[model samples]
Target: MYTKELFHSWVPKVLQKIFLFVLAIPLLVGSSIYTANMGDMYSGLGTYAETLTFANYSSTIGMMVGLGVILKIKPRFKSKNIIVFAFISLGLLTLAIGSTQRIDIIVVCSVIMGFIKVFGMIELVVPIMFIVSPKGDRGEFYVVFYPLILGASQLVGFLTANLAYNLNWNAVYLMSAIILFGCALLCIALMHNKWTAKRMPIKGLDWFSIVSFTAACLLLNYILVFAKQQGWFYASMNLRLALAAFIICAALFIYRQRTAAIPFFSLAIFTKRRVLTAIVLFSLMGMFTATSSLQSALTSILQYDARTNATINLAMIPGIILGGFICAMWFKREGSTRSLLFIAFSCFLLNTICLYFLISPVVDIRYFILPTFAKGLGMALVYISGGFYFASSLKPTELMGAYPVVIGIRSFIGTAFFSAVFSWGLYQFQSDSMMELANGMDTMDAWVQARGGGMQLYASVRTQSTLIAVKELFGYTALAGILVLVYILLHPFHHLHRRQLIIRRKRLKGESIDGLRAESFDGKDITATAASVST
Candidate 1:
């Protein structure tokens, strides 16, 4: 994260700030467009696991390689001509192939677009740097803008999802292109390479890890998204590819990081037991919480069978909103990290309890309500308290890049992988139970009914073993939650905690009399300390 010295001497040069505002808008939306069409892309990519795998493979590799190129060739605060080129190229590439159904062409075009998206992610900020011209506001500026980008993504996702649905995929993509091009024009005006001169050391390429990770991710996506449709290898080639992808990815990822001079991942980062523990705990807690997959589990187990499965999975929104609202209010009053974390973890465990032992078969939907609502609230609590763990744990520099990477990896890869594991575990356990029970009868109705489904092929229960499968998913997630609790408890984050204490001491000592005494572990403390003081 940035310190005050990183900001411009005074106000951002007006022209540059305006230019950055223009540049920031679309780079934010590009990903949302991807997300809005995320479900569509999976369905549209291809039929088999191989096609989907390659589709994902191309996107992942392309994005990584593209990001690598940007970091290598233009890794700086210099003139962003190359970045501008990358942005337009990716935007057009993304726009061009949005409605495409042809699998081969989609893969090729997606690879090309990968470069564009990667470029935007890496370089879009290049332009925004000009706006943060006030060196003192560097950290503060990041606080203001980073969420602008993320919030915009959410906004675009919400805005476009229905539009895509209503207009057919054709106009949706066309609109995506138009929005991107608009962003490109903004970049041309606002985005400049500010960090071009003070370059961060560029790491070399890890083709094996890159390919393997990408393949694994894509494989996982295919397996997760289409597993039920394909019957989870009880009936498909996709399973073979998925197993291969996971093995290849896991093996290569571990090997490359262990040996590479500058590995894509650093097992060493976890040398700080606290960071490792935090990652483990966060990851564990993440496994069962109101993730998209968890919500899906809820629907699958709750007998909410419909032609549309994804739709039944929206129980977590109210929970999330409630969490956000509680956080907003609570942060305004008793900004207690310990309290927030306790509430979140407790609620999370309690929600697990709700799903685990309390949920009953033949229960009202109301029985299911509390679990998701609690989950949503819990996520907010974790987010706020997550700041404290990071603060109390790592060094300033470590804090800057450390947790953000955790955030990114968790969102991008970690969550998905765990999701696959959860589902696979459920399938294995449930299928085995179903088989063991059915072994006695060998009759269709007896077997179906025993598995908790109706004998009728078209009946609601025909598609749902909601209670059975969910109990399994919840059981797995709960175990993960336990792992999280243990790791966090054992972990040592005293280094960052010391830093936070020092800052708080200085602040109380009147260091922030005119300005914030807080330094960013990538701005986690940005508004937090102020909120704490107010409380």
Candidate 2:
């Protein structure tokens, strides 16, 4: 039977596929609702911006933990039941997020929602993968898959922004909860409660490793998010203690992973050169993407309210679609990874340059379109290319074990660290600019007196200083992008198609292809140890 038939026999196969796709939408949206409506959440909850950052960090960490354990979790329950439970739990969490005034409660709920949401995502993604690539060719599957995921994310961001703009920020959460609950009902009606795979006993699940890793991540996030406000590491008692706790937790988790009979995830994956290279590339991508946070500050400086800012972000959708199209075409041709990285960084450089020149106190909103589009396109390219690169660097058995580490580094750890650094840099530049501009202002002059005295003059200075600070940050980012692009040009890289051809030739000749398989199919040494199997 086809995978679509697994859903239900009453409907046509095509219709079942469509139905499953529709049900998947709510799961996707609910997973990222907090991030899409970040500005509104800050306003509604009356909390510091760091609180929201912590909430996002918590959710992402939870996602990492979920992905780590999902293999074990899947065998214990039916796909349909997992979907139902995930949706109901996420729906209630959505309500809880909307109902609460306490940031702590919202964060706790976000972490739990993040964990359960993965179960639902897997059920949808696996069937969709079967439909997209029945032959189980990951390259072919990703050509279609990346675009779908990125497109949905951009669309969700735009819609949620509009919802928050039209109603209250809390309304977005309410809408999400309603959709989730509705999906739970649809799952009950449309999907069967039969297990798709044979039942396996759950054993040797290292729950301690998961908890320790999560605690370490949260502690590290707490330090980053609050460092600026608390006066960095040396000045704050809480920050110092958090750092100590983070070290202990991280050490414990690493030790457990190394010594435990069934490690939560294999640490051996990190020993590969290609995997390390992918991590560096992903870190750079994260830093580039984190610059988008400056858009909020820029919009606020331009006196655009939340709604207008959200409207401006809609400009990214077209670029996102275009980027996906490019990736699909690139993968179809089995293009060079170097060429992809070059194009991606070029887009980022262009985005930074555009924003650098466009940061004025008074500028047309239309001026933002090109930069935002470039930003969106760059993001899509990096995300897709990075995932493919990471996957190619590992063996099939190692893929699942390495997934959480790659995702955690790419999505949470790298992004959060850079975001905090950018925030701190912006603050420092703004402070310097403020003092310099203030020193130059002649408050006693007749023109200044005519302009409503000291308060008016101070406001003008602050505005100009903010504009200068933003421009400086963008300029620095552009320089960094240029260096990366040059490195890509100088690097020795082979086309993925060429590598695949070599592998095929080696296989046909009955030669040992183990070395090629060990290192992105690049004909490397095969002496590397295999990844440890998780129990």
**Best TM-score among the predictions, by candidate number:** 2
- In order of appearance, the predictions have TM-scores of 0.63, 0.90
Model 1: lDDT to the true structure: 0.54
Candidate 1 per-residue lDDT, tens place, 1-535, comes to: 2221212334366655565555556654554225444455555554553354445435654564454344444443344555566556765666657756676776777666654665555444544543443342232333344335444544555555666566554566677667666766655554443443555555466678667656665556566545655777768887777877788776877788788786655566677654664565466555654344555555544555321332322445555555655655554453544455656777787678776774344556666667756765566556544644544454433443354346534443455556566666666665666655545543356666666554443333322444566676777667766665555455443335556677678877876544435443422443322111100
Error of 1 at 421 (Å): 2.8
lDDT by residue (tens digit), candidate 2, 1-535: 2232456777677888888789877776556345667878887778788888888778878888888888887777777888899999998998988888998898898789888877888778777767776765555566567666666776777778778878888888888889889988888987876767666777667889988998998999899888888888878999999999999999999999999988998999999766777788888888788887776778888888665766666777677778778877776666667788789888888988998888887889999899888877887787777667667667756777887878788878788888888888889999999999888788899999998999999898888888888888888888989898887788654444666778889889998787665234322221122222222
Stretches off by above 4 angstroms in model 2 are 1-5, 492-535
Alpha carbon lDDT of each predicted model: 0.54, 0.78
Candidate 1, residue 364: CA error in Å?
9.5
Candidate 1's C-alpha runs over 4 A off are 1-22, 32-70, 76-83, 104-115, 124-154, 189-267, 289-291, 297-340, 350-377, 380-408, 425-464, 475-483, 486-491, 495-535
Best by lDDT: 2
